[model samples]
Target: MAANKAFRFFDLPPELRGAVFSQLLVSDESIILHDTTFFTLPSAGNWNFLNVFLVNMQMYQEASAIFYSMNRFTLNAHSHRLPVHLTSRGGFLSEEGKDARRRVRNLTLYLTRVGGEFERVIGPALSDMVLNGNLRELVMRLGPPSSLGASRPPERDMEQRPPFQALLRLLADPYLEKVKLLAWKAHLAIFCPFHLRINSSRTDTESVDNQGIAILRNSTGWVELDWRAMVDVYAPGQKIVRIGDRTY
Candidate 1:
């Protein structure tokens, strides 16, 4: 009887190998990421996710690039609209010299409000990484509507809120085209038993702030972002006025 040969993945051509890798690794939909994404969600010690890459160096190198580059990652947040889960370390991408973080091409932030930072993850860290890094797109879920609501506009601008300033700066970067800016209509369904059209129905006939709020409300839930309106909404604080428009 003839001896049977074992299958060797490395034996395939690099192009063919990448094609195969893409099939196994890439996802048509985004992968929702959290602090414990690569870890055990239930503490069952299943160890079945990226741990598969540990089989060998070549497999890890080849597979990781396709995975991070081809897929979209959505980083979730707590109910408070703050990403307390993603610290300065930034859990997943920040791992092992940011080999994975640098490879990321698409990222989305899910939040109830346009609030605080992921510390070093999404602030200056994002712009700095996007310089040489493969990050080509970013999306943020602007909200369901703040609990504070339009009547009580919290200090929710980029400068006042923790992450908005950094995020706005990143979106404004010439490298990232205008079309890439996207967001979901912030829903205030959580307060629905006591809900009805509030800010969403208001016309721009009111104050200047109400005008910006009107523009933002026109979005059909998830849609390409309006940077101009965003700028109007988060326009510089009194400090900037005192110093002049030089900062922006």
Candidate 2:
């Protein structure tokens, strides 16, 4: 009888191995992180790719970069300590960390409140990413400002909205291609594009079809989002803002 030989995954060509890694890790859908737990909104299941990194030292080095680079991560600014989490793994201390941070292209930050001292809370995370990471796109979701015994400003006061102002500073970076400011009102959600001409005085509303999704356009760009449908899908029972004829 002839002896049987074992097959080794690393024996494969580098390109083939990279292709396999991409298939398992790359996802266009956003991966969400609320506090410590991580999940995906579009696809909810017990799915994780961390094990792929634990296979071996070499695989860990290669796969970790692929995972971070290929997927967009969504984190709640108020809940998660993002900078601490990113730097805790020790990868950020070495060349791998630099590569991983540079690969990070997109991020979405959910802000529960948007007023006084808000920048102190979320500024560090944004600063680290903007200065070091190769961030191309940013999405900001502004939830209802805190109403707990404190005097909160009116919803229409754009000048006082610190988060919005922070986003404007971020958008000033020429490398950043897109920045979306999504706000949730009493029973209506508003969408605005934060761009170079964001301060320009122009507001135009595109017509909505049978569905309650409206596309708002201005000189900067257009924001087309179905907040009602999104709430039903990602956040059920949450009071979604109605799509109204408002100019941004």
Candidate 3:
């Protein structure tokens, strides 16, 4: 009599079995129903795919772990109109935390004028994730403002640059180490005033960090920020606004 498929899967040397499964798992395409069923069926993949990789176990754990680490979400201001789309597709706020942990290691928030209150929704979302010690890398896109709805005043727009101030405050927690801000407009730019406090423990410092607006009068368009350099810009002890580099 032939060995059962499930028996065959477990029968292979444990190392060999894990390698084969990992090869089959890593792919550019999304996993399908049959693919899921193959690993899920009684005679096929382990029933603990969700937990073994997400929560408990260690040996075959990395095999399960890869699935969670690879989950990445890209948010655009255009789609910002339908925020539920992000919440559903990204699974950022899963009750189990494991689901969220599995997929939300890297977050890319795309900016378009269409996504209402991009800061309101994305800011708090990222902050919550940071507080939970789950977020890894945060990437911000500075694209044209969302035009799908009413427009904001020019002054409000200046204030809305990158939530660098809020982000620095949150990053004081220390677990989070990397933050990148990508700018899309020549005139619109964000810079943390030098002398940003590392730990906002003092209450009566009486000196609120200056919120200086950077005005760039060029048209190079959107450019991704340098992570290392950004840290210096936000580091405590630097001045509010100072001339550094110009491409014009």
Leading candidate by lDDT: 1
Count of backbone clashes, every candidate in sequence: 5, 4, 13
lDDT of each: 0.54, 0.53, 0.44
Report the lDDT tens digits of candidate 2 across residue range 30-66: 8764322233434425666677877899998787677
What number of backbone clashes does candidate 1 have, counting pairs of residues 3 or more apart or in separate chains? 5
Report the C-alpha lDDT of model 1 over 1-248, residue by residue, as the tens digit. 33797778799999999998776677767776655345232322454647647779998888888877788777665256344445436565344435556667887766555454454445554565477788777775555444324433444332445565555566666454322444334432211122223466664221224323322354344544555445445544312121123455
- TM-score for each prediction? 0.64, 0.55, 0.49
Over 36-91, each residue of candidate 3 has an lDDT whose tens digit, in order, gives: 11223233254444444443355345555454344344544444353443445333
Q: What TM-score does prediction 3 earn?
A: 0.49
Q: Which ten residues in a row have the lowest lDDT in candidate 3?
A: 32-41
Off by over 4 Å in 2: 1-4, 34-48, 78-103, 144-151, 154-164, 185-248
* Model 1 lDDT on a 0 to 1 scale: 0.54
Indicate which candidate wins on TM-score. 1
Q: Tell how far residue 5 is off in model 3, in angstroms.
A: 5.4
lDDT of 3 at 127: 70
lDDT of residue 200 for candidate 1: 62
Q: How well does model 2 score by local distance difference test?
A: 0.53
